[model samples]
Target: MGLGLGFELLKTEGAARRGRLTTAHGAVETPAFMPVGTVGTVKGMLPGSVRETGAQILLGNTYHLMLRPTAERVAQFGGLHRFMNWNGPILTDSGGFQVMSLSDLRTLDEDGVTFKSHLDGRRHRLTPERSMRIQHLLDSNVTMCLDECTPFPATHEVAEKSMRLSMRWARRSRDAFVERPGYGLFGIVQGGVYPDLRAESVEALTGIGFDGYAVGGLAVGEGQQMMFDVLDFTTPLMPADRPRYLMGVGRPSDLIGAVRRGIDMFDCVMPTRSGRTGQAFVRRGVLNMRNARHAHDTRPLDEECRCPACRDYTRGYLHHLFRAGEMLGPMLLTWHNLTYYQDLMAELRRAIEEGCFERRAAELEAGLALGDLPAVPDPLAGPVAAPPVPEESSSVPVDL
Candidate 1:
């Protein structure tokens, strides 16, 4: 399936995989977490900063890029890597998920999907051929096939119908793909939460073939256990030789769990999005930086980490930035959270290579389960009449 590059499965511990994917840009370590750069840039981050966070790859959105500056315009600028100045592997979504998210504005047919841009009311058509063309124009190292993201809680009948349509599209996407040295195409398997449909989907996509196979249509409305259950039965059925990707998923815990179940690659906006919203991820779980508790706390975000935010800034300063609505708040938090995710992936890879995946995963989960460290004790008269709550906002968030 790899025309110019291949995935090397370097090690395994149970279902966990420690592998490397070679691409024109560079090699991506498996169980890799790709930061979402929806519109050609990882928001608030320089390419060097992203590299500092240990990110070997980034994810781009076809729909967003196509809408704003337009894919053709990007091609004129010498593709996404040059336009964005990111010199690593880039994977482009087929624009299918974004199109499906606009269900009210989109129409589906055997040939393709036609939808209006969320930005403007202007119309655009996305076929397997067009998606392939767009990613190619952007010089994507890895391109996803166009496929409908099946809704969760779907009846078997409905899920099967959606999956069949996607399989057809996957074939068209493969046929339309322009193979080049170091670039590869991946097919997405979609089948709601139905096991039978999932099996059928695995068979279909593998038969058609791809450089990698992705498990799509998850983390939509399905709960974590259901999502894990889907993976539990699904990954065992995919090709062992090719990389296995889990798309649009998830929290740190989800990444760990999926890697345990054999997923090699993942992309989601959770870290960056959560960062912008004042949420910071730590090994002991997420902490709300905007909470009044952090406004007085003098500790770094995480004492164990070395990211800039945690290395140079204190929690109090971060809280003040968010309170004042400063731009640097999101920037610092984004950097810290990305560093946490990448560090977790590195640990997982090491665990697999060292043959201690189960033990390491359990230890990581234990830390997260312990929750945010107990509220730092404040002495003297219940913190001296519970220091006046900052009134920078309409209502203060609960201090935890």
Candidate 2:
């Protein structure tokens, strides 16, 4: 066995935990939010900007990089960090999720998966060994085991079969991963929404051993309540010393709820993806900046936000940019959304450390429940605006 990765659990309040994770690139405080940086780059922001947002790590997609530039090319360029100009820690997914979601044709068997690329019509095969190799080439600090993301609504029988296949893959992945100091592999637990299956998955992964553990196959359309119910039983069973990650999870409320349930790390595309669509995640709730109500409003997206978009510009300007199809619109919103997520994580860590996680969680839930503030009325369409003129019929006899 390799020298295991360092994970120091500092404090715990109820199920909430405050800890630190030491990686090859850097140390990440627990209850961390890893912005999705698929394809070696976080969608619209610069590396430095991402750091400024308080993000210590990013999650890269193994499926995308392996197909596009190819892992060999990324390795030639001194790995993903140098290539993407991000010097922080990176956790790479095992490509199984994307293979099932994005690919047109896919066949999964005990050996592995064979699929056609969504990017081009190219054929590709991904086994646990190949998945391990791809992440290794990318020089990822945290590598996830290749496992099927059990589809939601699957029968108990189907879920069991999928979970068993993933368990088999987990063993192969563990064996295939090359041991190196400061680098670690994570095992994924994949058991749809069934508590028994989830428990079995946890037993299997823990038996094989991993530096960290991730609860996969969630946020796949199962509502938050069900996801939390899974966590209720699942997280308690995870090894307390190792970091616990919830993959592809959720809105701000989802993050807070998961953290309250003892999840130490999370990765999601919601922030960046929503940002691109003119949505801003604020303390109160989500704001749709594309609305006409913001057309003449001069207030910032969130008065408390320190992000450049909120610090310097008005909602009016953001609305105009989106309306005008400006690229900067997405860039600014993405930066702000990422900053918001990191800030939330920081707050959670602080709460847990202070032994007031429950209070903080209640506060977060209350704030989210408030929803978006009432939109500012259009300033230009005041009562002094011009009145509508009645039009006379063209056939009317009128004197000029």
Candidate 3:
């Protein structure tokens, strides 16, 4: 193994953690939210703009990149960060989830998954070794092991079979990974929603060992409660000294819940995807900018947000841009939403460091539960004060 990546746990409040992850490219603060850059881009925003949103890391999709530009071609251009013009740390998924979810005529066996591309009728096979190689070619700072993402509502027998297969593949991935300083491979924990299966999977991964561990097989139609339930039992079993990432997770509330459960990292498409659809995530909840009520509203989307969209544009203007089908609408909203998520992660880290995570989490949940702000407010009013942070004695675990 080359120089191993480092993780420093600075503080913890209950299960919440404040840590730092040092990668080959740079260091990422935890709890952190990595913006998804599927196909080597973060949709409508520039790489520099993404960094301006306070994102220290970005996620690339192996399935998409391998199929389109091809990982080898990306390597010719000197890896994803340079190819995409983003200098931050990049983590690449092993393509297992997308293979199962997006491909057709899929077949899973001991070797790996074989499927026809969703983009075309071309067929391909992805094994653990091949997935690791692809990530390496793309120069990922963090590479994920290829594992089956067990579908929701699976029977115990089915889930067990799937998880066992993933564990076997994980071992192969670990052996295949090329150890390098500041670059690490992560194993995915599968088992659907069963605690015993989850525990078994964790044990298997730990035995094989990787640089990091990811909680997979959740957020795939399983409700938030069940997801949280899984995290409750699963996270503690993971190596406490390493980073714990929850893959393809979630709404803003989901991030908070997972962080409180000891997860240090998360990546999701909700913020950017929603932004493209005229949705904005704010401290108080989601705002649909397409609503008629905003046609004449001059207020910023969220007065507290410092993103250009909020600082320089009004709700009415955003509504007009969306209605007119302007590309700038998605660009601005994506930037704003990404900023909001990063800001939330920063606040969570601060609260954990301060030993007030429980109190801070309560205030966040209460704010989100209030839903989007009312259609009208006093023009001169400031952003609403977050509900008081509960006293330590009065604080309780936030219910998702």
Q: Which candidate number would show the highest lDDT if scored against the true structure?
A: 1
TM-score of each: 0.94, 0.95, 0.93
Which ranges in model 1 have alpha carbons more than 4 Å from their true place? 377-400
Looking at model 1, residue 109 earns an lDDT score of: 95
The 10 consecutive residues of candidate 3 with the worst lDDT sum are 377-386
Tens digits of per-residue lDDT, candidate 3, 1-400, equal 3436789989988889899999989999999999999999999998889999999999999999999999999999999989999988999999999998853468888999898888887998899999999999999999999998899899999999999999999999989999999999998999999999999999999888788899999998989999999999999999998899999988999999999999999999999999999999998999998988787788999999999999999998999999999999998999999999999999999898888999999999999999876686445555665566568666554432
Full candidate order by TM-score, most accurate first? 2, 1, 3
Which 10-residue window in model 2 sums to the lowest lDDT? 391-400
Cα lDDT, model 1, residue 38: 94
lDDT of 2 by residue, 1-400 (tens): 5545899999999889999999888899999999999998899998999999999999999999999899999999999999999988999999999998853589888899999988777889999999999999999999999999888889999999999999999999999999888899999998888999999999999999999999999998889999999999999999999999999988999999999899999999999999999999998988998988888889898888999999999999999999999999999999999999999999999998888989988998898789877876665664553344457634544332
C-alpha root-mean-square deviation, each candidate: 6.1, 4.5, 10.1
Count clashing residue pairs per candidate.
0, 0, 0
Clashing pairs in 2: none
Q: What is the lDDT of candidate 2?
A: 0.92
lDDT of 1 by residue, 67-184 (tens): 8899999999999999999999999999998999998999999999989988779999999999999999999999999999998778989899999999999999999998898999
Candidate 2 TM-score, true structure as reference: 0.95
lDDT over C-alpha atoms for residue 12 of model 1: 95
